[model samples]
Target: MRKYLIFIFIVLAVAGCKKKNKAVTSTIPGKPALTTPAQNSVCISGTIISATESQVLFTWNPAVNTDSYDLVLKNLLTYTSTTINTIDTKINATLLRNTPYEWYISAKQNSSSTTTQSDGWKFYNSGAGIVSYPPFPADIMYPAFGQVITPSNGKIELYWAGNSVGNNIASYTVCLGTTSNPPAIKNGLTESQLKDVAVTANTTYYWRIITFDADGNYTDSGLFQFKIQ
Candidate 1:
């Protein structure tokens, strides 16, 4: 009878240990949401241009069960990205002038390896000179910066906002490839958007737009990337 009781006690202890392990493994943190530099925002003001230049302040909402957050900022023109880790909800970062950038946040917990990411957003810096002057470069609209599309979605549709300056935009061109500085895939495109472009699953593609003005002036929209799901 004593041996049997000891065996039963051992079984109960093992079951309780399993339950505790399961609970710890299921603890997942929620994704942090970005607040500033709203999606597709243009001409964001309040940039300080001094010897000690001011940094761009990024803000986001707190996430549940998150111990820290990772902020990622990317320069579309330079193809450079910066990642910073913080325990708070905001960070001040030095960025490029007259450039468009995309940013996103990830929620992280020290105990768990899993992380959640927020939707990406884009904004243009208010540089010293008139960045949006005539013959402006086309601003990409679809397949947003850092977007993922599943293979089952079929052909991808590429879209962009045409130059707003004078009637200078005579035509637009698109360059797409598996690597950076993708060569011009389609040139002399008159429309602002393209459709039925083939893409492979589990692959990343970089794209850019080249704008030509009636006066023979041309501008290039820096690089943007997206992944196939």
Candidate 2:
């Protein structure tokens, strides 16, 4: 009788253990932190592939609950982008020399469908015999291309961000009008924003930014447009 009671107790304990959940807990992926080719800095350490290209090493800190990372590298001059996937923290890529580029990392996990992206960083790929770099094309921050907005105050602000090697920026030129090729409405502005620009309702406007370095090198921000409702 004593042996039977011990066997029943063991069976009951096994059943209790089997009832517990075996699945692991899950959480959203954290944003990756960039390490090398630091933000808004020049990248001078790389193997020279040729007069037009160089191999760059990209490194970043690991994010929590991330299983993989996708590196997005964009040529700011040509407006072209490349995507690379890896399960590691660092990678080597060959890119165009003497050009400005921006990069970011997207983190993903197999257990979840969501993804996290890290902040973007811009760098100039220095090549042999290169002396200076032009400012990166101004990044349009407000009223994105083709965005429709209503100006309650009869005006809207235009803003942009610019960067260059050695911080050699001189001024920015803002061109705005209804035509695709707008004329310069403002020039030699040292600020990043244009405030209190009057607008008309139910009209589309086109604009672009021209960034000039202190050495007279200039880069266009390309064209962007928005509609006022």
Q: Highest TM-score, which number?
A: 2
Q: What is candidate 2's TM-score against the reference?
A: 0.86
Which has the greatest lDDT?
Answer: 2
lDDT of 1 at 167: 61
Worst 10 residues of 2 by lDDT: 18-27
Question: Over the stretch 34-123, how does candidate 1's per-residue lDDT look in tens digits?
Answer: 888776565445467663344688899999989999999877656689999999998887776666677999899888898999998777
- What Cα-based lDDT does every candidate model obtain? 0.79, 0.91
TM-score of each: 0.61, 0.86
lDDT of 2 at 28: 80
Report the Cα lDDT for candidate 2. 0.91
lDDT of 2 by residue, 147-211 (tens): 99889689999999988886889999999999999999999999989999999999999999999
